[model samples]
Target: MRRIMLLLILYSSKASFSYWSRQMNGIRVSGWLVSCSYSHFTTSCH
Candidate 1:
């Protein structure tokens, strides 16, 4: 029982870490898109 519980904890921690990594990647891509869009807008305006 104790071993099962330890395994569960380790698995959950890794799952959460992967989830956070994916979220970070999404945020980085969105930020880059936003900057590119802003630059395009300014260039078009001028």
Candidate 2:
């Protein structure tokens, strides 16, 4: 019983970690894109 519980906890924690990492990556990508776009816009305006 203890082994099964440990396995379950490990499995769920890994799953959550992957999900959190992917979410953080998405936010970083979006931020980078916004900055790139803003710079492009400023250059074009000038």
Best by TM-score: 1
Q: What C-alpha lDDT values do all the predictions have?
A: 0.88, 0.89
lDDT tens string, model 1, 1-46?
9999999999999989989999999999999888888988777522
* lDDT measured at residue 7 in model 1 versus the true structure, 0 to 100: 100
TM-score of each: 0.59, 0.58
Tens digits of lDDT, candidate 2, 1-46:
9999999999999999989999999999998888888988777522
Regions more than 4 Å wrong, model 2: 1-11, 44-46
Report the poorest 10 consecutive residues by lDDT, candidate 1: 37-46
Candidate 1 off by > 4 Å: 1-11, 43-46
How big is the positional error of residue 10 in model 2, measured in Å on the Cα after superposition? 6.3
